[model samples]
Target: MYNIGIDLGGTNIAVGIVTKEGKVLKKTSVPARAERPFDQIFADMASCIRQLFAETGIKESEIESIGIGTPGCIDTEKGILIFAGNFKYGKNIDYRAEMAKHFDIPVYIGNDANVAALAEVRAGAAKGVKNAIMITLGTGVGGGIIIDGKIFEGAYSAAGELGHIVLISNGEQCSCGRKGCWEAYASVTALVRQTKAAMLANPDSIMNKTPLEQVSGRTAFDAAKKGDKAALAVVDQYQEYITEGLADMINIFSPEVIVVGGGISKEGDYLLNPVREKIKSRVFGIGLLPDRKILPAELGNDAGIIGAAMLHA
Candidate 1:
């Protein structure tokens, strides 16, 4: 049977029809309207689903279940979004219950990061691994851990918060009101912030070519490729911080694989090579290193939808 996957992000909601083998039969996007009322957002999502089915000629009867991947600290059992920094109105939204009532079908809800990890474990980079971790370095760092093919939510259903782990003592400030979080250094937001700070020191750097508002990991990477010494130095510094924190995670969890996700990771070896070198240089247990592969995420943006679909199936 087919499955329906919904990836609800702050900017857009992506819905897909996923086959059992992990192929996407159909997919579409709709504005999340985070600033508007929640009811409107829900209506838009339902409309997107209807439009997708109509365009694809896929009967709802063929679908076995539906799943939603949302950004936040989610109470998976209750299917409620406990808190989300992206969506101001997402607090305590019982999305699964509401969707079930509306569609007359069972619904599963999961954190976006956890859902991506689920996707990787099931069909993507970590496919055959019994233990794995997925880290997405975006606006903020998000992580998920999978052991023996099941999600490892803690007793409070809030485990796998690896990004919040302190990498430095009393260092940079984080959006979560914490100081010295790994995210404060490893996230794309942090990279851009650091780039801008470094740009101020080197006024003639190529980083100045990109407007501050539009500066992203891509811009920084492009500049570094063009022999922009300042940009490359910033990236080196960022990679060092990421390696320091990731070494801790490896020493603690020792997962078989660690899949890196998000826009920065799209740079492939440009990002992965340095991270791997640093992790090996700092962490102990060389045998553990043999089993670990610091791989780029294969599913890209679709991991969330693919994983969310598995939640119900």
Candidate 2:
């Protein structure tokens, strides 16, 4: 039997047909345009599935279930997306119920981070590990926690919000309406802000060559490679903060591995190596590093859809 995975994000809706082994056989993408009517956007999302069905010629009866990874608080028991910051969805949006009008398959919903973690453990970076955590750094921060081989969502499917943890008391305010959140310091958004702040200090910095609006998470790393002191400082500080945050997570879970994903993970070793070393140095207990490790995520963007499809697995 096959499964359908839908990745509903802020700007795009991606639907795919996935096999039990976590491979996507067919997939398509469409604009979500979440600012429009909820039902309308959902219709377009459903249409993508229909288009896939037509192209693949797969009968509805062959599909076992449908899994969705959404960017917000998911009421798993109710299949309701409680809220979505980027998607602008409100509470009580019966997402599964609305989609049910189109197909009769079983539907499972989960937080994007949690679902991504599920995907990793099933077939990606953490495949063989018993316990792992996935941290996705993007416009904001998203995370998933796994313990004893199952997702540890705690209560209300809100347990793995690793980004909102207090990092620096009374420091930068976060989108979650809190101050000193780890997300405020370690996210790509925070990296951009940090790069900009350093650029303002060093007029002759290599980053000045680019428009301020175009400066991205890679700006500091790019300029630092050219031996710019300002850029190097920003990179160092960013890594330091990320190290502390990883240390905090290590203290809490001490999982076999910590998987880092999202746009920033593209940096690969340049990012993961330093953070791992720092975490190794700062975490509780003093001794040589054991089997615990921090590795960059392997699945890339497909993690969302594949993980979503595995919801029923």
Candidate 3:
């Protein structure tokens, strides 16, 4: 039987018809226009699902279940979106019941990052692995932890917040209102900040050619590739910050693999090789335990849909 997956984002609601093995048979999306009421958003979701079925000529009976990967803290058992700052609508919205208004099918909900991690473990970078951690380095750092082939949602269904761990006391400020959080140091936002700072301090650097407003996560990495000394220093420091958090995660979970996703992972080995080398010494008993592999996420944008579809598994 097929499963339907919904990737509900602030900007778009993406729906997909997926096979048991995580392949997307058909997919489509609708604008979320999140400022609207929750009811209207869900109606659009149902409409999109129906449209997919019409386009694919698939019947409702062929669908085994429907799953949604949404932003914010999710009450999976209750199907509630506890809080999502990006949405104008207030918290505690019942998502499962809302979708159920359209279809009589078992629906599951999971945090977007968690589902993405599930996608990696089941079909992407960590495929065939029973235990893994996926870290997404985007505007902020997002984490998904899987143990024994299942998502490890802790009490209150809010575990896997790896980025909030403090990397330094009284250090840089973070969006989570914490000082010195790992995300404040290692996220792509932080990388851009560091790049701008280095460019300002070293006017001769290759990155300074770009206007400060145009500086982005790729600015430093791109300059470093050309052997720019200041840019290289910025990249080295950024990688160290990333390694610090990764080492801590390794010491804590010791998962078989760590899958790096999101925008930065696009750099591939250029971004991971140095972190891998640096992590060797930081992890405890590095030689005694089998080496943990770090890999880029393979599913890319499809991970959200594929992972949401597998929530029942």
**Which model scores highest in TM-score?**
3
lDDT of 3 by residue, 1-313 (tens): 9999999887888999999999999999988898998899888988888999999999999999899998888798988989986667569998878888999988999999999999999989999999899999999999999999999999878999988999999899999898999999999999999999999899999999989999989999999999999999999999999999999988999999999999889999999999999999989997898779989999998888999999987
After superposition, candidate 2 runs with Cα above 4 Å error: 288-291
lDDT of residue 131 for candidate 1: 89
For 1-313, candidate 2 gives per-residue lDDT tens digits of: 8999888888788899999999999999998787887888778878898899999998889999899999887788889988886677666788789889888999989888998998898889999788998898888778999887778888898899999999999999999999999999999999999999888888999899988999999999988888999998999899898888888888889888889898888888888787877666687784655846888898887888998899885
Model 1 stretches with alpha carbons more than 4 Å out? 211-214, 287-291
For model 3, the run of ten residues with the poorest summed lDDT: 81-90
Ranking by lDDT: 3, 2, 1
TM-score of each: 0.93, 0.96, 0.98
What C-alpha lDDT does candidate 2 achieve relative to the native structure?
0.87
Clashing pairs in 3: none
Per-residue error for 306 in candidate 1, Å, reads 0.7
Clash number for each model: 0, 0, 0
Please give the TM-score that candidate 2 achieves against the real structure.
0.96
From the highest TM-score down, the ranking of the candidates is 3, 2, 1
Model 1 lDDT per residue over 156-231, tens place: 6789888999988898999888999999999999998998887788899988988788777776678888999998
